[model samples]
Target: MCHIASGWLYGGICRSKLRRHYSLPEAPCSDSLIHCCCRACALTQEYTELKIRGVDPSIGWKANVEKWNREGLEPPIVAPGMAR
Candidate 1:
């Protein structure tokens, strides 16, 4: 998703296109443009968010769903649906 968004920022580095038609500036695009510049930090932020929410991203989504069902807990896979 971040990669898709970088185009408007004229970003093509990191998770972006890696191709060029116009010159890209050597500055940050937007406050949320982490993936186009700092991928590690972006990943860390996601990991931290999951940890803070008590959701282990290392576990596959399906496994989490199964575990939630077994434990009678609500699953964390609700956002991807709700975002739509």
Candidate 2:
């Protein structure tokens, strides 16, 4: 049940990026099916890709946010009326 939901979410995310950023016409349907059977491998690939792109996932979100603040990086924008 979790795999089904997660696969759908990630597949939508990957497909959106592939089409908009990479100019890809189609993402394979088999990718979602594969994710159902092999979620760990799918997430491993995602982690590896993030690492290759110079982002460290191990430090996690809150720590990374603090680090970015200390480094004087721009904070992410919040939508109007949204709490920080």
Candidate 3:
């Protein structure tokens, strides 16, 4: 179920964040289309983006929040449906 949600639902969000964080210009196409066309590349890009931002995607969300709190940094703001 988690895998399904991540692939089907969260893929676009990940790409959006990568684009926004790097200040990349809008793509000529939508993220879903990109993901559909090149899933491996899209997922790799997303993983690399998270690593570049110092977020370990392997760790669960709660651990990430705890890490942020311990470091005296606030976690990134959550979108409505993304709250865990």
Please, what is the TM-score per model? Answer: 0.51, 0.46, 0.60
Question: Which candidate should be chosen as best, given lDDT against the real structure?
Answer: 3
Q: List the residue pairs that clash in candidate 2.
A: none
For candidate 3, give the lDDT.
Answer: 0.72
Q: How do all the candidates rank in terms of TM-score, highest first?
A: 3, 1, 2
lDDT of 1 by residue, 1-84 (tens): 986765535432432331111222334454237655676675675567566555777896578778888999984432321222
Give lDDT for model 1: 0.52
Rank by lDDT (best first)? 3, 2, 1
Positional deviation of 20 in candidate 1, in angstroms?
30
Which candidate would rank higher by TM-score, 1 or 3? 3
- Clash number for every model? 0, 0, 0
What lDDT tens digits, residue by residue, belong to model 2 across residues 15-56? 455334423334345555645666777677666755554457
Candidate 2 Cα RMSD (Å): 9.4
Better TM-score candidate (2, 3): 3
Writing each residue's lDDT as its tens digit, candidate 3 over 1-84 gives 768746734677678876776555556778877786778888897788577766788996689879999999976643233224
Report, for every candidate in turn, its global Cα lDDT versus the true structure: 0.52, 0.58, 0.72
lDDT of 3 at 19: 77
